[model samples]
Target: MITGYVIARKPMYDFSDVIIGRNSLLRIEDKYYHGIDRLNWIDVESRFKQSAIPENLLNVYTDLEASEQDLTGIKVLKKYDEAVVLMSLDEEMTLKNEILVIASNKLNQIKGHGIATVQTITWLGYDIVLLGGWSLIRHAIFENRQMSLLKVIALNSFGLLDNEEQADDFLKQYNKLADLDSVDPLLDNSSYGVDCIRVGVL
Candidate 1:
């Protein structure tokens, strides 16, 4: 079992509820930040740049409505809702020596649980782009049900760190290595250029 903090950012769609449906991903959960979860530093013009996020607080702030104030980040949005998930992974379910993260826009679908044929639709390098305030890097697919939630934020967001110093410090302390070219036979398909996780029978 591999344990870590996963922060997910969904850029395109706004969902009312985020459901976890996979067994490979266990202990699906999230954290609540009272005063720290404010969208004070989010700006529309600041595209391609990382936003200011307080420590230990997942930055779920999305700049959907630029003029709206106190709009409850990820709580309620006129257009869409963004969220972050934290959970664990069962390595035995993954392709040996390969770590896969899935970011899907689906609000009620997940990868099918149990051993089956999992294919890699594409390769999203560690330096992933951040369209929304954050990114979810866990694996989502076309399936019916299961458990777990590992947040995978945008690579550019660097876990939504405030500055270069913090980002660099984060890189230095990080030690997990995922093979971008590995062939995983029992994983979910990863979609590119869009946040889409389809649920299909395996």
Candidate 2:
């Protein structure tokens, strides 16, 4: 199990009760700070630098109304609307994960060749990704759902921390060498209750 502080987070979606479904991505666009009608669904591919087209057509929508299509077959992975946190598992579990952090924009991004995506979707609107094998808590996010909250901020916005010293500091403290097979993340349950847990918007 992982034991860490959820130091920061951006807000979750304002998925309101609807009067219409004609367009639903407007709130999403707003969440990522997009201008009205300035967004293009086709632009998503380039923004995420994705070579393969997404399986779900609704993934790149630019509307203000939502439908069942928005879920893309992914069941919501966490309950109590548990806002995904920036989890840095304990050193005991770190040998497996090695504190690797990556940046991602795809909700369905795969954990390939010993890689795992970070639980947090956005940090001040930039995608937070991880690179390592999955622990039980981290794995649950993937096993229960096939989709991730798509990284919605603009491509240029990704530069927010790319050139800063803080980014380097974040990378240095988080990364570790590979040795993932030994740890059993299933045995840990520190995230559900408050030992070192704190959940809310940043």
Candidate 3:
């Protein structure tokens, strides 16, 4: 099974919306019963971009949030509660070669953040296609693509590395890539841990 994690800017909606009813119409009933509003991709993405603490974090923050909607039918095993550190897996395991990452807003907006600093690194072209952030996931899932990778990491967790020394050490171990030139910065790298997905061909 292809495995990866998503660090979302917001908590995932409970999976109930996708499973509670026998038919699509019934599902709509269930949604109304459960008070789950249908969330459009654009709505969700905008929410994250606006809620993100530092304005600059918008790039990565929106990227991860948008990816979640890409799957045809996705289930959320865990969700953010007043902000959380969580992981997600596709129940059908349909994704063949995709990697995804999901992170919370807290983690996305730190000043002098190495992850952000290295944003340029994501552009390096690699064997794998890097669709910029979450939008790619949405495209893949909507288009019914067979294999994709998503990388979602919570920015809040990285807050621990606020110290420059610690941040640098973390980058040395996690961000170093032999094929930095191969990754496409605009493509999504959330599937393989951000550090592992190279800029070159996958």
Candidate 4:
């Protein structure tokens, strides 16, 4: 099974057809690739089934002490935290520009302190929504010593078309997705990412 920590997941349609020639996105270790490029959906599903979800990370961090260096550094920035998980649990559908930005914006809208960021991690396996934002937010509350069950770190998943005819029709109707006036999802998600891993250290 592939192993890695999740950071953030985004919705909306990109050039999956043109770029990777498949619908599912997968990240193995630190590299992102189309799931079909390496393995079929069945294998992907089985792997995820065997792989640990973000919620399971709590067991690893519980009772562990974090040092200052663990909170900041190049290694910390690019490194994956087994506890800091991100997931996309929807079919790859074309999104209206505004629609995709909503989930990524949640962190910036609320994280009043610290460096927050966002990254895309695709959940190509099953229908499980495991701990969506709770995994990260729980860490946040644990850091502040005001622990509760409110999961604030947001994640998003969008629907995608499996049929070539549907995708072609979508492209025709949309006509220039890039030029279509829409908020950039990445621009707003930077800080969200920072806050996500921040809790892992705490």
Candidate 5:
């Protein structure tokens, strides 16, 4: 029943013709992270552990916010780089028969902003698709035909494997599309990317 949306914006800044300003990049990063943190707190408190929000997840989000501030203080020398902002909400309550009024209200806030939409496709499988913006041009999940199952594996963090052999067994299902250039053979056929990694565990 985990679900949410993400928004990405390109910061508008002007710098000298030859070099881009560091302060501009910092400002954009600050705004982006701030938005993400705000959405995370709202979602966690209102849904995930509504009965009793865990202090650990709260603390981790706080720490991440602080780190983003530190990142803003650093100087940047690049001009034409892409910056991304993501916000997500996951709740078990949605599985219940009763619909969550509060969660619905919060979702309405993101309407028409070109954020990515997340939804359940099966009892234990979920699908996340980007839309309405440049972000949609890229596929967040793997593109291979057999690797469609990899989406489920990645969403569950490869839960099917307890040891290397088990992981290899799972990988065997998608051997045709696996990347073989890596030193580790198991990684050869995997398509998990940096964006899918969960930031905080609750």
Candidate 6:
């Protein structure tokens, strides 16, 4: 896992695809390659499953805790004393971004001040959603906290194909590149082609 501490807050950048790609690179130890691959997704998922519910972090800030709040149009997938995990319930097939933000705000308000530090993670069921321009992975990275991790799972050739008919052709190209151990070149110097992308702040 890429580990680093937040020394100071940096100015938030304007929302853009490039910013998301850069943050995705920060999750890995490398800073040069702002791209991702299958192995990177596995690593990121492992980290999330391992650290999804922090056990010791709550103790560090005794004054901050969670409280009972009415959350409508959202489902609580995981509930813990220190954290409440939520998933979208809308039938529109996209995450209700405001619900997560509202939950975070409620958690912050529980402390009666701005002492609570809230972080969010979003998982997209369809790999094609990454190109939808509405995915929350980018917001989870730069907008939530100074240091954060963003993880996304994309399908094989999902990023390169323009339509379903091109799947076969793109898959062949991707496979050939993978065989040559030069898959990064197929990414077009971006993280979009990777099966998974992870950006984290420890």
Q: What is the C-alpha RMSD of each candidate to the true structure, in Å?
A: 20.4, 20.0, 17.4, 18.7, 18.2, 17.2
Q: After superposition, how far is residue 10 of candidate 1 from its true place, in Å?
A: 8.6
**TM-scores for all predictions:** 0.17, 0.17, 0.19, 0.18, 0.17, 0.21
Candidate with best lDDT: 6
Q: Can you tell me which runs of candidate 4 are displaced by over 4 Å?
A: 1-46, 51-80, 83-105, 110-202
Q: lDDT by residue for model 2 over 1-202, one digit each (tens)? A: 1111121111122121221453422233233221111111212223234543333432422121121133321111221112111122223222221111222223223211222333552342222222122222112111221112122212223222222223333322223111232222322332221011111121
- Candidate 3 regions with alpha-carbon error over 4 angstroms: 1-4, 8-13, 21-46, 49-53, 62-202
Q: Which one wins by TM-score: 3 or 5?
A: 3
Q: Give per-residue CA lDDT, model 1, range 1-202, as digits (tens).
A: 1111112322211122333343322112321111111222222113214432332323333432332232212222111112121111222212111222323232212221222223333323222112222222221111111112112222222212222233232222221221222211222333322222221110
TM-score between model 2 and native:
0.17
TM-score of 3: 0.19
Q: Against the true structure, whose TM-score is highest?
A: 6
**Native-referenced Cα lDDT, model 3:** 0.25
Cα lDDT tens digits, model 5, 38-105, are 11223333433454534544544443334324222111111111111112223332221111101112
Model 1: per-residue Cα lDDT at residue 190:
31
Clashes of each: 23, 14, 64, 17, 3, 4
Q: Give the TM-score of candidate 6.
A: 0.21
Better of 4 and 6 by lDDT: 6
Model 6 alpha-carbon drift over 4 Å, by segment: 1-85, 88-160, 184-202
